[model samples]
Target: MLDEGFTYGGLLMGLAALVLWIRLALRAFPSVETMIARYQDEFVVPEARSHGELGRIAACATAMALTFSAIGYAIPD
Candidate 1:
């Protein structure tokens, strides 16, 4: 049960990260600025429009790492 759940979860997360990386490499990632502006009615974009491509990538990687670590902490062995 442990390997079945945790390994599969890790695999799924890896695939998601791979897809995001492909989008970044192909310049297919959506406009961060436009998204922030579009959804201004709901909430706030913490980084604003000033976080450029590299910044966005860094943020994504950091976020993914954090979330991935969360899965580990959530499912104890």
Candidate 2:
């Protein structure tokens, strides 16, 4: 019973993290025009760079979520 609860909790948290990742990605790369504009400026594109960083963070969050869910599923009742 307790193990099942952990599994549910992990699934919920994982879903939340996945949603967050999607939101971050959508906000960062909304359109081609916006992306091109960000890079069109000089070699140094702060906005694009920041978005890339956010993407990395989002990826990390997703990874953590997966790990947590896996651990929860592996736990014994």
Candidate 3:
């Protein structure tokens, strides 16, 4: 079962999703920081707050995806 295409394909897909979520989550943080730095003149920037919210959402999604990846890896077909 482990050598079969289904298992390999599923693993590959899980890995790809995990990587994408992690990358998005990481990028959101820096982008938020940059926006805040670039717009320091403004007392409050809605865009920065939105980006921060996006970062939190992405981080949560990444954590969930990572947990699923770990579970998938731990359990064998």
What Cα-based lDDT does every candidate model obtain?
0.60, 0.69, 0.59
Residue-level lDDT tens digits of model 3 in 13-75: 657657666766665565566577667875544344345555566566556556655665666
The estimated TM-scores of all candidates read: 0.39, 0.51, 0.40
How much is 21 displaced in model 1, in angstroms? 0.2
lDDT of 2 at 41: 79
**How many clashing residue pairs appear in each of the predictions shown?**
0, 0, 0
Better of 1 and 3 by lDDT: 1
Which sections of candidate 3 miss by over 4 Å? 1-3, 32-77
- Candidates sorted by TM-score, best first: 2, 3, 1
* Candidate 1 Cα deviation (angstroms), residue 33: 21
State which candidate, 1 or 3, has the greater TM-score: 3
Which candidate should be chosen as best, given lDDT against the real structure? Answer: 2
Query: Which pairs clash in the backbone of model 3?
Result: none
